[model samples]
Target chain A: MNNFDVTVIGGGPAGLAAAIKACDEGARVLLIEREERLGGMLKQCIHDGFGLSRFGERLAGPEYVERFMDKLSEKTVDVRLLTFVTRIEKTAEGFCVVTVSRDGLERISTKTIVLATGCRERTAKQVFIHGTRPAGVFTAGTAQHFTNRLGVMPTKKCVILGSGDIGLIMARRLTLEGAKVLGVYEINPTPSGLTRNIHQCLHDYDIPLYLSHTVTRVFGADRLEAVEICEVDESYKPIESTKVRVDCDALIVSVGLIPENELAESVGVELDSHTKGPVCDCQLMTSVDGIFSCGNALHVNDLVDFVSASGELAGLSAAHYAKKAQCKVNIKIGNEFLYLVPQQLDLNADNSRVTFYFRSKAVREKSLLRLTVDGQEVFKRVYPFLRPPEMQQLVLNMDKFAVQNGSDVRFSIEVAE
Target chain B: MKSFNCIGCPKGCLLCVEEENGEFTVTGNTCENGKRFAISEMTEPKRTICSTVKTVFEDAPVLPVKVSSDIPKDRIFDVMREINAVLLDKRIDRGDTVIENVLGLGVDVISTSDILNRK
Candidate 1:
């Protein structure tokens, strides 16, 4: 049995950042990761577009995580690798987190917890495509893990579905590995991945992209032989006669990412119906007091930079709540945008500054993302573009609004251009 | 007018280009960037090259590699030669400079995939 002031779960980018921050704030922290390695999914991602904003230099995912891992080594944070957290329960004292590692089953008690379980890929089982059972079907992430990290090519001729960032990246990765990528299929009329990724990964590779289309049926009983792709209407129903059959050996799906919140649910944390993660206040505390959540486990993030930044807040919040730091003012979600973090704000909240990360329902061009409190706009910016696929981050100084000390503050986005 | 699809974006804009004398007028694009993109496609096209080459390493069969820059559409075969000639040891790691300043294009060939130690 082990006890700590703070228990950080899932040692991915979020958990690592939170643990490091908590330790820096003079709190004893425990970081537990399920994988044998400490870096989490970032370890498998070999692309270099990461760390543009967080580190200022464009680096591969491993390099970006190496920085955090190095920081952890320098801090007092304790890390446990290959540890699976089975359940989390609240007690009269605080929270009890149960896990099993190489040593055996273990229990830890902490006053505050941070859930960073990350997310999982949506697979064919979840999509439920009507087809004969065949081999060579893989989630884009899984195939990427195999080919990019493990040096194994999953297949030769392939058709990728979902046009996700991972799928787009895999299309390029597979192509580089001597695999024939017929095309990428997306149900949405536009790409669900970042614009730069679409341009660089698929467009650059001459891999065709079929928008508003998806695979309706799979062929081949033993190994994937071919797939039937068709265009769909607005409601996602396939239009008749639009089916196009393409010969392929494999199908990689990158449909979407779902937050892995089973443990959170076991602990009875309130969930945001929209984000599908635990409902967290500005402090990153979940519905259950002192049980915080961040990273992809909180919400699927488009960029890892946002995940690290959000985890920093979760760490500081856990530290402050443990010490019962004083502050006032609560921030709330306003119109158009999905939800804002720190559900509550502190007027005295380190007036240094606060950055809000959010997403829109649809693509908006030449717009203004505005931050407001009680229907009055406090901050507004001319954002040339915004997309549901891309997260929009807005930073504002709490000092600007600390004077008002308004009880009900809200944040939202609107077009001003 | 001849209709050719401009593979500019996922939108796949169908371009209407009419050539009179020696100049071309292109239209049917959603953005101004698309308009310029269509003209460039009709004139000279370049595509990003992504392909693996033989390596000297045996820890794994091959080390996944890629051209550091977009290759001229016509020079793809030529680029493949340069990529094929090089043989890297199993020690090749991701983002490592596989071919320094490849083809004098100021871009280095790099490993796109991480090659882990075979345990």
Candidate 2:
């Protein structure tokens, strides 16, 4: 039986960071990756504008991840490439992770486990694009993989169904590859991607963006030949009279990404409905003892920098984890937020320098984010503007608030008059 | 007055540029980079492009490359033509220039990864 201090799943940027940090903490760490390479999605993300916050330089995704891969090479973390985790069983000591590889099934025991499985793109069917199963339909990430990694063009002409970041980037990428991107149709009134992405990717290429519009149906049998695009009303119901047929070979969807948390859920970890991920504490520890969730498995993050940051924190916490009773308290949020990560705080653990990631429910010109504890205002910060697409990060010293087991920690954003 | 979204950073500040007698006045920039970006947008818009070049390696079909600096945005397709024409037969490390002074723009297309060499 193989035994380790920590086991980090999914060899993406987050997993690599976790394994490296855990190794640096002098803990025996094992990194499991389903793919042969370690870069994960970064391998397919050939675009730049990554690592602007972490490395302070706008680097290509591969370059950004390679920096961590370089650091990982120097560490003694045990890496298992082309290994898939099948099951995780809780034990008295810690956990027994069952995995399958070319060698066959094997079980490894670890004191603590870090979930960094990342997120999966919502497919066309998931977004309710009614049609016969076609070959040309692809998620934005899949299109990116085919184009950037395999050097294969997924479509000659395409209509992107979402304004998400990946969709916006692919619009530019496919255009650069001599493909004709007709237009990007977004269901929401406002663009779902970052302001920078909209400017750099779509606006730069002169690709038309139709807001409050969505693809309702596909009209093809073998390969996608056309799609029915229609405008939506306030409740997001498609307006039947506004249906317009757009001729295109492919339909690339970038509706949204959902965190890959099935493994965590299988381990009996409580999930937050808002994040669609594990309900985590300030240290990124999940409800399950000796188990921690980070990166996309904790919450879908807008930036890769924040994903790596959460992975590092989870790795550090896992490396130093010990079996102890936790005094956890929920951190409530008002309806103004789209979602917030680190849904709770373990009062028993160190509460200083707690990082919280959140997004606004809608666009706000001027607002103030207030933090209240036990009916008393503890912290507040004013913002010039807030948007759902752009996530915000705040690191606060929760120790100063004197948060106890029953402390009422509430977060709300108030629009400025 | 011409309005532009300064892509200097992710903040995407709405920059309003005014020109009078070949002199530009830019506002709504949070940093000096934003101001410089606005001026460049007004004069000659330049952008850094990252893409892949064909490689002979079976394990890695394409190698990612990016301009050493920003190039004229209008000449992007021209540069892409130059990039797509290359069939890299030699194994190069990261930061190795795939093309020097690409299309006489004074920007070299450099490999962003050493995946080929690693394999």
Candidate 3:
């Protein structure tokens, strides 16, 4: 069996960054990808707007990942493309990762494993769009692949359901390609995408964004012909009185993204109810020791920059991880937050430099985010606005918090009265 | 007077531009980039266009390309048209210039990905 200090599954940005960081830390690393290419979904994301935080430049998705891929190619880490890890068994001596590739089945043992298996887009079935399975119905990612990668026009006239980032981007992309985008419909009262995307993609393009509206059902036999748009109430209950019919040839859905955690679940890693990713400590190690998770596999991050940051953390931690009793301090947050990453803190480790990624539960104006340890305020920042679609990140120095194994850590957001 | 929300960062600060005596004053910016973005929004807006160029490779039908620098906002469609018309006949890696000094503009239409040469 091949052996390495760190084995990263999925060669996306997270895995690439993780493998590279581990290798840089003097750990023998192996990166395995299921696709022929190292880039994950970034390959098909041709639009610019990435790397604003990391590189301080507006780079395209491919370009953003190309930077990481280039650095990784120069490293000593072993990269295996078109290789899929089938099963992972926790043995007494680290973890045994079984794989299936062109050469057939093989096994590799690694001291620590980083699950960077990214996320998958939610399909129409998950959103409960009732209709005959038509040819024109496509997910936002599929449409992007057809347009950006294959150079094929997936639709002529389309109605997008969900104002998610992909849907908003596709609305502009399709419009730029001479397609007719009727309008973007969202069940939520507010837009689901970033405000900047709304300004540039939809508003700049003259495309309409209809809030509190959704596609209840679609019509068509051979291809999509029409869709039933209904207005939803505060509780998302469909108001039958406000049902309207819109004619469109295609229905593109970008409901949401779900973290791929079946592999983590198979290995008995605890999952968080809010983020749907593994319950990880400040070190990014999951409830199962020696197994870490990062990137979208940990939580669906709005920005790819944060994904790379989390991967770096997980990789650096995995490389330095030793079999020792972890003293973890639980972190609690109020209902003001949708979720927070690094659910717990490793008291035994250096908790001084912790990168926290979080999002408010609702749209908040003039809000203050306070981090308190042992009932003492350590850090607090007031933001002008906070939206669920935009994630906020902070690199905090926890040294002054004087945290201990039994210390209570809490985070909360208070809106200005 | 005009207003814009700076997309330069996640802060998304609302920037208001007021013109008095042919001079512009930007306010409500959380950072220096916001002021610059506000000035650009009031004057000439520039944006970078990223799209795919047709390729001869069958395995990879299109190669992703982008302008090396931002162009005038009004010239986005012109850049896209020039990008769409070019059909790459030779294998080119990332950073290879697809069209040098495109349309007399300072930026070059360069390949942003190496997918065409991978196969």
The CAPRI-style docking tier of model 3 reads: medium
Candidate 1 residue pairs in backbone clash: A281-A342, A281-A343, A282-A342, A282-A343, A328-A346, A328-A347, A329-A345, A330-A345, A331-A345
Candidate 1 local lDDT, A1-417, one digit each (tens): 377888999888999999999998888899999887777898767666677677666466766786788789889888888988998877877888888988998888888998888999989888857789899899998998787555578989999999889999899878765789999999989889877687668866799999999999999989999999999999888997898899999999999999889999988887776688887655677777788898999999887888998788889888767444545565656556665554556443465566666777778876776666667777777866667887766666766663465555766667774
All candidates: TM-score: 0.81, 0.99, 0.96
Q: Cα lDDT for residue A110, model 1?
A: 87
- Name the regions of candidate 2 deviating beyond 4 angstroms: none
lDDT of 3 by residue, A39-91 (tens): 89999998888898788887888889988998997899999989999999999
Q: Which model scores highest in DockQ?
A: 2
Interface DockQ per candidate: 0.13, 0.79, 0.67
Report the poorest 10 consecutive residues by lDDT, candidate 3 chain B: B4-13
What lDDT is reached at residue B82 by model 3?
Answer: 91
Candidate closer to the true structure by lDDT (higher is better), 1 or 2? 2
**Backbone clashes in model 3, listed as residue pairs:** none
Q: Model 3, B29: alpha-carbon shift in Å? A: 2.1
**Model 2 over residues A271-349: C-alpha lDDT tens digits?**
9998899999998989999899988888888889999999999999999999888899999999999899899999899
* Candidate 2 CAPRI grade: medium
